[model samples]
Target: MKFSYDYIKSGNATCVLEMGKERFEFYPTFHSDALGDFVSYLASVHPLCKLSWKEGAFHKINGGITWETGTYLLRWELKRDFEDLEIKITEWQNPMIDRKGDSQLIRKVLEAKCNFNEFVLCVVKELDRVIKQRGILGYRQEWQGYTFPIDGFLDLKYACLYKKPFEITKKNNGTSLEAELNLLMEKMD
Candidate 1:
């Protein structure tokens, strides 16, 4: 699986998810920092690996994007068994559902299974490219609603590289991951 996001305008982006031969694209509006929300969701779930003794066997997270006609939701379901992780991606279309828990008679746009780590790495690589192209301050100026979620992005990247789930408390407390990412970004500038 491959994921990438492209900034289209001041407050809009196109997120693309490619799984083997299939490619799905979504247009997410910056109603409340769409990229931040999406990355935060990923960071929240990245710690749920079965290898982590404190984590669970199954987990689910949902995120929504405003499409041209209706709202499109990407539902991520993660199931882990011992050493394997399976990620299920389901896209739904509904005109009335705008938030994560909102439910209705939705149209199923697509459904597929993909690798969890690969998906995370793809997003990490793409986001790194975006940050390189648009500096951190520039991203905040263009993204508008909220600043880029460097904390979440770095947390996930560290987890992927080290092959371990990051500590939620540390991330929430702005300790390890946030501090390291801040120092790295400062060095870059």
Candidate 2:
């Protein structure tokens, strides 16, 4: 089976999962904590699932029927969320219903739809590309200093702030020194 995916932002993050000619779109709520969890899950769990299910059993299991079944569930959930959103919107517009209660209900439904596990998985996968491209995982430092070295590159004002002294090697060129100085100044203020 041919599969592809894309992500779009329209007030909220939306993931579009494409399987062959069919397309399924999911909108996941934007929350820092939830997005962090989704990123971690994609970095760990998703690869294993794709290897085990998509490659191993997916092709052999009843000529891909199992994969189709899972897609069916995803489609059903998407449709149900759409219907719920519509109902909530209508209720919110009604004159008899308490305005506050209707608003709350609408928010609740939107949150539920956005937090659905299947939708979240798709979102994580799509976002992983962006995270990787940004080089987020490449930098690993156990301890980060607040100021630059005190030798030639340091600003006298912030030199005392850095407890550990780092040698000003040739690699610490003018551009890097300027960048570090700017960063330190930003932090100090």
Candidate 3:
């Protein structure tokens, strides 16, 4: 497995995930509701992992997933109020009928494409099963992203307001999704 990170913003702002065989073409897209739904899913799977939403952040107890590298803590709380939210699940699958709950960020995370592999999609599919069978939030996602440092980087206590994200369409007929992200990266630079 390999790990690489790119800070989409300043500070220690980074998107870090372990990769092996697979390549991450873009960040996972999810709906705003999915964020809360993920919290509900965790409650069903891990009976002992106590989690809740309070004080504008999500909190959880000594909870984590055992990985070969180490015990990665699967806990974090958003610093920003995620209202007026917009999330785009890259795939067209409908979550309400699929049993993955209304907030479907997990599905997007599980379906993302990497350098030469795809595990995100499989993760989403299996997570749905785990949620159904165990009826709890048993899965532990790596703690990624932080708003505090990013806030400091921008010298603001709150994040900038933005509209719901939409799928950036491609201009050419043959351009793949990867190509779109590539173009986006180039333009960002």
Candidate 4:
């Protein structure tokens, strides 16, 4: 099997790997120290390295392993067939940001160990709840005159889950925003 990988540094950092037509994406949130430690271990064993035991196989080559970094949890999973691998680093506690609802949703998803689709569903549900409670105009007003585009959030969700590019324009009009929210909720269903 051929192995190839690339790291994408953008709004959020991600490492992508491709084996044949199959691709896997990893969101590496590790700080320098934790990442350096993992890389050093990998290099120490060279071509034949077994970092740790996981599900009867070496975690570095197959199976999954998790590391706790006080502030976040770093998880790595390698498929048995070697067709895919994923590494996710997420915060242990929700940040004290103004986006309380968003932060709470993220915390719930991480704590529940939900999969990609589950995560998207959770987001959609939370969005629906918020929209229902506060009409689109009210929701926009809560953002302090800032344009909080739901489509952008949807694009990010789709990209992370499907590993493809997606784009959507910002919706400023209340009618348009409500329509878009309804459409997204329908899509999730």
Candidate 5:
């Protein structure tokens, strides 16, 4: 995740979440510089060590852990010990955000015992990718959503992705993930 925000405008940006030796990409509403701020939010929110820098890259930008069917599943790995954390699209909540239809998403996060700062990180972290290559969302991960995280209004990018259904070609592993996610959601419900 290299940042050239000095030249880049538009609140929209892309991110690669890394955990222990794994990485995953998600679309964010900010530039590359924002990735560190984003990761700091994760380190503070999730039970993890302090996230920092090792010269240029994130010291532990390695892999990600997402909640699929209530399980902390490891889906990808990183060049470093850490993997990228991801927002599985299977858990997108924009419909609910629309239903609430306001900054109610913010209130939702507060209700979940998250402070304002925490909510911001969650919002950024939960953002879905509009993969440029596919022009659609991909690999939805149904992670746990905090209580009123969506009430405070959302960035249009994240909000809009949820308003429509984005699917992938049948040949890719997309179908497998969709099917598996459906079963996971059913059992979770």
Candidate 6:
């Protein structure tokens, strides 16, 4: 699995998620902190990695992102049970239309089981690349309406690097990974 984020224009970025031959692309408009919203969703869902064994364990992550078209919205859903991670992408048509008197239909565009660990790692690596390619201030300049989510990104990165889910409150300390993370954070700042 691979994840990428590229700034395409003002207030717009193209993001891609792919595994093997299947690739899905979506545009995230930073009109009102969309990047923060999506990252927050990932941070919220990722803690499930440590709780995948709970009985009757079921988890879902849902998010809506506006597309560049201004008329279409992409609905993203991630479902996890045990070691299975099912991700679905659907197109919500005519979001501006009132649903009170009309029927709205959504079309599923992509559905696949994305590996949980791979997905997390791919996101961390890609964001790390973006940070390195574009400095911290550059990211803020490119991604308007929000700053780079370093706290969430570092938590996810530490979880992937140390092979343990570490929340912001319980960060891994006194380790090479911590040193690296701190250095990266400094560079970004």
Q: Model 4, range 59-111, lDDT digits (tens) per residue?
A: 24333244443344455432221322232334333233233434333221121
Regions of candidate 1 where Cα sits further than 4 Å from its true position: 48-105, 165-189
TM-score of each: 0.66, 0.25, 0.20, 0.29, 0.21, 0.73
The 10-residue segment of model 1 with minimum total lDDT is: 49-58
**Highest-lDDT candidate:** 6
Per-residue error at 160 for model 2, in Å? 46
> Which is the better candidate, 3 or 5, if ranked by lDDT?
5
Model 1 lDDT per residue over 27-137, tens place? 766665667766766665665433232344223444432333247655555454444445555556553556664465455546565566777778877777777778788
> Which ranges in model 4 have alpha carbons more than 4 Å from their true place?
1-113, 153-189
How displaced is residue 19 in candidate 5, in Å? Answer: 7.8
Off by over 4 Å in 3: 2-5, 10-19, 28-48, 51-189
Query: Which structure is stronger by TM-score: 5 or 6?
Result: 6
The TM-score, computed over Cα atoms with residue i paired to residue i, of candidate 5 is: 0.21
Residue range 110-141, candidate 2, lDDT tens digits: 21223233433334333434333322232111
4 against 5, candidate with superior TM-score: 4
Residues 70-142 of candidate 3 have per-residue lDDT tens digits of: 1111222111112211112223333344555343332233333232112222223333333333332221222
Task: Identify the candidate with maximal TM-score.
Answer: 6
Better of 1 and 5 by lDDT: 1
Q: Report residue 107 deviation for candidate 3 (angstroms).
A: 12
- What does the lDDT read for residue 21 in candidate 4? 58
Candidate 6 C-alpha lDDT tens digits along 66-91: 34324566766666555566777787
> In model 5, where do residues sit more than 4 Å from their true spots?
1-8, 17-23, 30-37, 42-90, 95-97, 100-189
The parts of candidate 2 lying over 4 Å away from their true place are 1-11, 32-35, 39-128, 132-189
> Where is model 2 poorest over a 10-residue stretch in terms of lDDT?
62-71
**In order, how many clashes per candidate?**
0, 0, 24, 0, 55, 0
